[model samples]
Target: MTQLKAGDPAPNFSAKDEQGNTISLGDYKGKKLVVFFYPKASTPGCTVEACNLNDNFERFQSLGYEILGVSADSAKRQSNFKTKYGFQYPLLADEDKAVIEAFGVWGPKKFMGKEYDGIHRTTFVIDEKGVIENVITKVKTKDHTAQILAD
Candidate 1:
């Protein structure tokens, strides 16, 4: 994986959200953004991470950060996950993998001794100027909000 780092320009992307509404990096211009990618929607680890963020949504917002989740799932699936968890943020249905590849979070991953190509669970913190402020690779799903706000 070509991990993005602080000081690097976040790769811009346009994709459809769970609601089938178009969303783009440009829409969040001049705002802090948290774009997180999960391997799949509604999975165990993904659920913990998303719920943690949702539970602390106001904290992030008060700090001027907008949260967005991304995964290579269909719009319906993304919508289901969001509605089920009552997440206040939008979940990007990056079915085309455009946003995933743009961020270079797609690569080989091993689970239970099975190796396959998939989206790596990652989070990117983008500053108001559209530059990356932090990249969380070793994510603690149950405590992701703390990790993002740690800086």
Candidate 2:
């Protein structure tokens, strides 16, 4: 995977959110952003990571950070996951993997001795100017917010 790093310019992207509303990176201009890419919606690790961020939504907002979740799932799936968990932030339905590829999180992964190409669970912290400030590859699902904050 061509992992993005601090000091890199975040790729510009536009995609439909879980609600089927158009969302673009431009929408968050001049604001600190946290773009997290999860493998699949409603899955075990994904759920914990998303819920942890949701539970600490206000904390991020208070710190001037806008959070966004991304995945290569269909809009319906994304919507269902968000509704079921009552996530406050928008989850992008990157069905085409456009956003996923732009962030360079699509690559090989291993699970239980099986290897396959998939979306890697990654998070990017972008500054107000759209430059990456941090990239978290080893994520702690239950304590993701803490990790981001600690960065």
Best by TM-score: 1
lDDT for each candidate structure = 0.95, 0.94
- Write candidate 2's Cα lDDT for 27-84 as tens digits: 9999999999999999999999999999999999999999999999999999999999
Local accuracy of candidate 1 as per-residue lDDT tens digits, 1-151: 7568899999989999999999998999989999999999989999999999999999999999999999999999999999999999999999999999999999999999999999999999999999999999989999999999999
TM-score of each: 0.98, 0.98
Pull out the clashing pairs in model 2. Answer: none
TM-score of 2: 0.98
Q: Where in model 2 is the C-alpha error above 4 Å?
A: none
Task: Indicate the worst ten consecutive residues by lDDT in candidate 1.
Answer: 1-10
CA error at residue 122 for candidate 1, angstroms: 0.5
